[model samples]
Target: MRHWRRIAVTLLPLLFALLHVSGVLHLQVLERLESIIYDTRLRATMPGTMDTRITIVDIDERSLERIGQWPWGRDRMARFATELLDRQQVAVLGFDVVFAEPDGSSGLASLQRLAQGPLAASPGFSEQLARLTPELDYDARFAQALQGRPVVLGYYFTSDRDGQARGVLPTPALSRDRLRGKPLRATSWQGHGSNIEVLAKAAPAAGFFNSITDSDGVVRSLPLLAEYQGQYYESLALAMLRVATGYSDLSPLYDAFSEFDHDVLSGVILAKGQSRLLLPVDPNLATLIPYRGPGDVSGGSYRYISASDVLEGRLPEASLKGQLVLVGSTAPGLVDLRVTPVGRTYPGVEAHANLLSAFLDGANVLQPNFAPDFDVLQLVVTGLLLALSLPLLTAGRAVLLSAGVLAGLVGLNLWLYQVQGLVMPLATVLVMALSAFTLNMVYGYFVESRTKRELAALFGTYVPPELVEEMLKEPERYSMDAANQELTVMFCDMRGFTALSEHMEPLQLQAMLNGVFSRLTHIIRSRRQGTIDKYMGDCVMAFWGAPVATPGHAELAVAAALEMTQAVALLNEEHHRQGLPQIGVGIGLNTGTMCVGDMGSDIRRSYTVIGDAVNLGSRLEGLSKTYGVTMVVSDTTRALAPGFIWQELDRVRVKGKAQAVTIYTPVGTEAEPLAPERQQRLATWQQLLAAYRAQEWDACTLLLRNLHAAEPGNILYSLYAGRVEALRVLPFQPDWDGATQFDTK
Candidate 1:
């Protein structure tokens, strides 16, 4: 159970991070909000102006009144055509009117007989019948004017499924049978022909010039081709284009922008590279027509001659040379007015002129095929980059990387649009980058804060005051599995602390221990170079090397030990003066291999050292009492502190050991180097140790007696003398080594 708990703690961070990243929980709402945000952005960023040119030719109410009602007589239409062809020159003429029924004025008696059917005897019925009989037959004269000339006619389609189709339709420009397989919304018309005889004999080709208005009444696109009765007929604009370019087949492309050359019909291509004008439309296939309004003389970018003035021969000959002329009514009451940005009552014919001008000039807005595809690509790239980078970098670095990714995506999109005429979605990519960055940051902050809280929870009381400084630096390092490294370990305990505790009440004893440990803890923490691993009642185990590394760990540890010994001395003096029992502390120092890391159950842990080295350090602390000294260190620590002054104590095997380990005491002050006299005394002690290890009992005792005479209260030298006397009594064996032993623990 304990092991499982430990493992769970170790993996908690990773599991939490995975949950946040998977987005199976709270992230759905975030994505939903992001989509709304992107849509709003697209609406705000829509362009104000389109880069296309189109024109309209209006059949106004004035033209209707001036040219004799709706259908002028055939002779008058022929005269209108002569004026256009002989005087004012036009590049092209497209008719916006259709004549589905035949002219009946010449057959007046037959029309009157047919009119005698339903309400023949009603009042004023005879006068009405007479008026209908004398009406002019405009079909004949219009046919004469169309002879050997390029003219296009207009017709409309009906949305009603059972539309009334009248008159024979003109021959189809393309087949519509294959289009039937695909499900499509088709426009059905009541009638097809605007002129039967006139279109058949006069015009070279005719087109359906039906303006399929949308519910909103905007005209953003024109259906260059449509299907009817298993046949596809061209529009009036398309027929005129065909005449101008001399092409027979027109293939429409749906995805790409329309393009044209000098040969309009053959050279036009859509988004899909088909040889047709692919117009971009909405769900309704309609958009607003940004019209430039009507011109004064019907001579905007093209030549427009008045019908009356042209018939009077008031125009010059040079102006009409080899030009395509269009004859249409321009009178106000003709009801050919339209609404546009430039004017509300603009002529409709000018719209067609604008389209011609736009095609001729090659100015059009190209909606590319790669835009939506690029948007999807941007989303994938942004999500992937953030996912990979966020986990591996610091908060600041992650933020910087996220910013770079966003900038790159946005910059690339802008370049594609500006340089290659591609329109890609920028909002999705931007949102992805920002959202990933923000979420990762939020997760990181939470993780870091949790890690700090964990550190404080586990190590706040167990670790030494000084180690807390490093823990605060980047508390995450104290997380489970913090690595063990080389370090200096120190163990300190109050001598006769058990006896002192027994003499006082439990509360009083705890208060005293707390007060003493508190002061010692302050000293350790103020040094800020090591952590006190833990306290065993009045004992402290500290080490320098985990959480942070220190190069002079041995030197610092030794300095701290010496300062602690002095503090204890002052404390004891104060205790004695107050008639309280004096407390002595013994400290053991060792520099060796030990594992310093978080060690314990998941619920409770301590940052401490463990290994054979730690046991040796504890054994050395016990030996401090045997020698009646306050501080002692193993030979390992002596070697590590090369600049510090150390005096030899003895060479003996500590409890639970067969191998003898040498111990020493720090005798140096704050001064730079040892005095000559102290150096000489240390040299004598080194000789004494060599003699003792060689089993020269007399020589070791002689040196120790001299050391005791020089410093009579030196318990370290006296203890060595007692050891030398005891070794002389041992029975010699052939395999027996000089290494000593401690029988008691």
Candidate 2:
């Protein structure tokens, strides 16, 4: 039976994994878990560090309202670039906006209309146009401005069924044959076309500034290289890099496509004599962007000069010297919005900034090529080990071995992340652990469930037979052991429980207690601050800072005490009209170090607390009877519960204790602790106690008389006055201890 159970344990996880792999079970839950892990990782990584250095040159709503709607003409853009190049002196410029069409500002179309008018006028226009045809074009001025400057054209690629290449591309240095027919992994974007003529004429270098967003609509990658037919073409960013480097001899290395170990290691090799720079590649041959958005109020680490300011020469030339500058619009009307992991409605330019920052800081996430193979290996090894070792070893030994395997898996993944910048899914290994553990547990449950008739008989009195069977298979989260720690203990007892039970029948009494206790239990468990440590008929015992250490246990205990008192009052009001006996409870709370956990034997376990502090709390609950108070607390609890209002009661050593622990009855607050009347009354009372302590009978009598005259209805003052009279008759003793012991519970 034991061997079969062990075998069953090993098979359970394997079955689950098979179900998961075969798509018979939902994998969305696992994916969601991964998302959570990634979110946690992102939060961990973001603190005290900024990874990207990209800033937005915003064309804000104000700019749009101030300037006009978007799609400003080429001449205006020419002026914007001239300002950046001449005044701000930016490093390089990449346009997020594409100029796909010619400038329509000049009256060439109107001139054509004029040409078809009068014969003499048309002949004159033809003769004049032949002499200055180049100068007559409206786009000629902008083209002149872009001549020989650092400008990259923009274009989009498509894979639509009807989509066809309409223009020529730069000569391919890396052909399809060289890449072993590996097509450039371009993002599939369906577009009408691009302003190829104007953009191509304006910029000498450009990349296809298009982003590949995931199903979640988050842009995470940008294709660096795309293929058309047998030719390899670069992205807008890549084109800009090529232009910057002046490298025309680009070549793709097929060996770079393979996974090293379990990580993806695709990168571009920029030819430079005998050396090359490896630019990291994404699954779509795009670069993973590491973005830094515009949080720098004072031009953090990087300077940002506006296009208008640059045009006006309001920037220093020295700032732009030897800098890699990105020129993009931050204008709201220009519509360059993008969503990222940490932000929504972020500027598209920030992606570029992040990519640049990642490059500068060497904070790139290396793609894991061997991840798939590694996962397979993990599954096989873990499956086989559990299948064999689980049956061979004892339960305890099996657990230890499983723990060791789990630890090894975790350690290996963490080491990869720390040492080689590789992020392996540590949770996958954890899945294996859970699978193995669950399989073992289920096997035990199934085997034990069949032969637990004796165990079922024992537990049937307290719980159902089904529950007994369940318990035999899987013991609930309970243990019979003592754990000592700081805790807040609460004991609530109904004042009139004895009277209520006498008047009601057995069923009625049961129903009444059940109704009250059920509500109270719900509150206790729902809050999760403490547990209902069993009901002592009418009294409830609850303690915090146990099972789990709650730092604010004292506060929680007091708060719970106050709420219970309020709830009991409301319940008493409801019972009064029903002819049921009205109920009230006196709650006593004490916060201090105590031992908590289950304390009974294995067959009959009960969760409870046992310590000196817990005993004092109960004693204080009984003391509430003598004090004529509803809620009572010890000095220890009062000190911790500073937010509450408390009135100090006389110190007394309860039965079986030498030291007097000061007990307090919370009578609420005094608005002014030193109001004239309260101050005078307090002073007179202190004088009376002092005289009584000194054995000055006459002085004590005079002070008590004066205090009683001033505040006759005050119970504390009356009690103290009476005590002074009684003490005056007693003979003085050399060893009259100050400890007052309570004779009753």
Candidate 3:
């Protein structure tokens, strides 16, 4: 029974762990925790230096100011792209901006409209408009500059309610027909804001620059492939990778489970003429953003060159030669800023630069199909192992075990991340293991300790004067204000006290009662650190784990109850020697949440509890006499203090309670082993109760007779024997549930 009770107690943590593993409860807090861990690991492992291959053509505040507040003429943009390609000799240029509308700043549209309309008859106006058209046609000039160059245009996808599609979309990297009959639930979009027809047609290739942000509004990962109208399109970084590697076809990979209805996206395969590269992706077909370091312009991960510098030819030709340039704005007014793992406020264009670098360097973070399964397995195995093992091991061994497990989990996660480029979840498993360890350690330190210093500090007044002075050394921490807390409460009463009191005079009886209480109160307060609530005539009420909380309060209370029983025996012996009446005590204990403080009126008050648990404790004390036992404890306390040997008393619905509660009596602590004869008697007692509850009167009577013969002084066995004989002659209802019901408190 004790072993089962301990196992039940240990399984409490497993319940929380299983919830996490099964995905029944999504812990948003853990996602945030994971984000923190990821950021920390990323920061610690990053190479805090620039990648010279990728350069960001930043349209910074300076460029915006010099270029006269954006919406820059296409002629200027044409000049910028032309300068980087022709003069600087860059390998490939990718724009992070969408030219979604025609350039109207040149006024060429109006001039052409006039030339073809009312001004057609005016030869002078027609001739002059045709000559000025060559220089004023900014869109044509920009398109001409992009021709024959390794340039990829940028576009964006939107899932807005309006579903409005603007401008022209480039050819998708992979068609939906190719992914037919497969579970390819990529991030889908209904509409797009794309480049104008001329710009889209002139660029060698194009890709969407839309970035998806997490719930926390951070760009930690981006979908490499998005779906629109049943077609798949590549991201800006993917397109750049294809152009850089000369890949012609992009293929989607899937991992299908035979038992599951759905398939998870594994990765994307980029196939060139003969060589192919497989890039890993999450189930969403997204890749984690592999940041280099703090993405600052001064000595950071990537070199940032102002657009104005590129256009003005201020940068050295050799610096830009063979570099991959990403053109985007860093001007605050342009709103091209993003929050990334590396930097809170980062340039959106640099994100693509980082992604491109990750691809070329084969550093993309992969979350394989089995990652979730592995995480759940890790959580269950490690959590259950630690939960079961930590209780048995010493504190030092527990700490060492926790450290070893933590180190192994972290070490393996880091190895997968750094060496294999896998990004398995570390937060959930790590948090569960750490939480289990810490909870167990805290319970051992705070609850398992036997020190009574804190108890003395709170209940010093009830102790001897010398002990009170020692407790008062630091008196400020103690208080008596009413507060709610979890505690173990006890109620004890002297049996047949009224009959004993009637024979004595008032003063003499008062003196006897006071003497009895003084002795019992000292045992309760001095040994167990219990607070004496108040004495109700012949009864004394006390509680543990109050005012100052101690772990294993239930165990302490039960132990105190056993000692009090012994104290009563000694007191009775002394009374017999003095020619006074001897008395017996019945004690009840319960553990639960209750209000414990100095609760009362201004004129008169007392520190006490008022809750269902307190009422139940008092009720159990009343039942001790009815059951012919010295002590009765609720099932809650029994379960909490598994280190003690207990006898199952009864399951009863007490007055004022709707639920039936099982009760027990603490026979002894494990430190004092039970005798073999007593153990056999207990086993027989259990069978007798089972038979009694089953209403097998003959079987119960036989067992009870044997038990009484073995221990004739055991009143509990004699009491049940009487009940079985009474029921034999009485008629009972057919629907009896075997649970005793008390109609009175």
Candidate 4:
């Protein structure tokens, strides 16, 4: 019963463990926690230095302020692109902006309308408009600047169901028919907001510049391939990489087990005349964005060149020569900012730059489909081991164990991330192990401690004060439920108590009784560390080996019985001095199996013992008067306390018991063995008992007389003498086993 509470306490962590392992409870909180950890690790491991191979032509605040707010004329943009390609000699160029509408700033359409309307017959107006057409047609001028240049235009995909599609879309990276009958669950869009037809035709290649944010609104990863109208399109980063690497063909890489399975889009294979590169992606064909560092203009991972400088040719040609350039804006008014793991407000263009950098470097983090399975395995193994081991250990050991497990989990996760470039889900595993450990520690301290204190209070009086403190250390190990256990029980009562109470006034009687019981309880508990079960008016019932187990319980009970008798004698002496009636107590001790615990009805309950052993102790206490002895113990107790000197009283069947038991009285400890004179008398008494049982009446009478004469005040010898006389007058039975039986209790 005692250990059951501890076992129950240990199982709490397992409950949470099972829920997490079985996926019954999705710990969304853990996911958030893991995100925080991921951000921290990402920042710590980032190469804060710059990457010089790629350059960003940022339309920064300075650029915007210097070159009249945004919508810079198409002619000016055309000149900017032409300058980077021809003058600066950049290897490749990509735009992170869209040109969905024609540049109507030149008012070319208005002039043409005027020529065709009211001025239809005006040759002079027609000639002037035709002459000014080349300068006024800004869209054609920008298109001509883009022709024959290695430029990739950027566009966006719309997921809104009701959004209207506009402009022209480039050829799909992978046509719908190529992916027929395959299970591709890539992000699909219903409509697109793309570049104008003239710009799209002039650009060598183009890709969507859409950034996908997670549920938490952080742009951690992006789909490399998205589906629109059953056709696949590449991201701006992938398209740029392809153009830079001279990859002409892009195809889906499926899992090896199933070729036509669209759902198993492992990655995309970029091929250029037999040279190929496999880009790993998640199930949705998304790749994690490997951020270099915070995208600062001065000392960040990528160099940022002001668009104004590039337009005005303020920078050296060597700076942009052979560099892969990405034209984007970082102005606040542009609203091209995002929340990223590295920075809260990050320029969306820098995200594509980082992705491009990762693709070229071949360092993109991969999250395979089996990562969640790994997470679950880690969570279950760590959680279950800790739950099972912690309960059996001390608080300090449990703490150490939990710390080691947590450290192992964190260390393994970081190792895989840093060394192998594997981005596993660390949040779920870490949170489960941490939560289980923390809950167990808290339960032990707050809940388990409270229960222990309560148990200590309940059993404080039942057991000795010293034992009570020991019980408090592990309260769960002890319980007050009735259970069978081998123990020692004792019953001590004051003789002639009824007559003494009748002679005294009620107050005097109460005072006397209280003093006697208090002194006797102190002897039983303080001397031998026994449990005081209860007080039956004139008798004190006590036991040992309950509430807390003690190996020498029988020995302690016998020692306490002797001390109680001595304590009563001292009390009698004080009573004689005060002219009060002297008191004598008789104690009985027995050792056997008994049921001990809190027992009673709802109205009241007590921590006590019950069984034949307890009954025998009470009956032995009653027989103390008949034998004229201070204390009597059954043979079981005498055997257990071999260190004590004893006198065998008789073999008798006690009241309400069918079996005969040998009873003895503990005279003193082995430290003071019996004297030779008392030893001689004991021998004579044994001989007299044997003769009486053998029906030698005359011989029994002679031996009893001599024993009584040797010790005239020995009432036990006189009682045996009288018993022999009574037996002589009755018919002796052949089956008599020399045992006495009492019918009354």
Number of backbone collisions per candidate = 40, 26, 1, 5
Worst 10 residues of 3 by lDDT: 1-10
* Number of residue pairs clashing in candidate 1, backbone atoms closer than 3 angstroms, sequence gap of 3 or more or interchain: 40
- CA-RMSD of model 4: 15.9
**lDDT of candidates 1 onward, in order:** 0.61, 0.63, 0.82, 0.83
Tens-digit lDDT string for candidate 1 (513-583): 88888777767656646677788868998887665667888877888888888888888887778667878
User: Judged by lDDT relative to the true structure, which candidate is superior, 1 or 4?
Assistant: 4
lDDT of 3 by residue, 280-373 (tens): 8887778888888777586388888889888788987667888888999878899988988778778888878888999998888867778878
- CA displacement after TM-score superposition, residue 688 of candidate 4 (Å): 70
lDDT for residue 489 in candidate 1, whole number 0-100: 89
lDDT of 2 by residue, 495-531 (tens): 8989998999999999989988876765564554566
lDDT of 4 by residue, 259-358 (tens): 3435577788989998999788887778888888876574388889899998888987666898889989888899998889887778888889888988
Q: What order do you get sorting by lDDT, best first?
A: 4, 3, 2, 1
* Better model by lDDT: candidate 1 vs candidate 3: 3
Compute each candidate's TM-score over C-alphas: 0.41, 0.52, 0.60, 0.60
Error of 2 at 251 (Å): 2.1
lDDT of model 4 at position 178: 74
Cα error, candidate 1, residue 195 (Å): 4.0
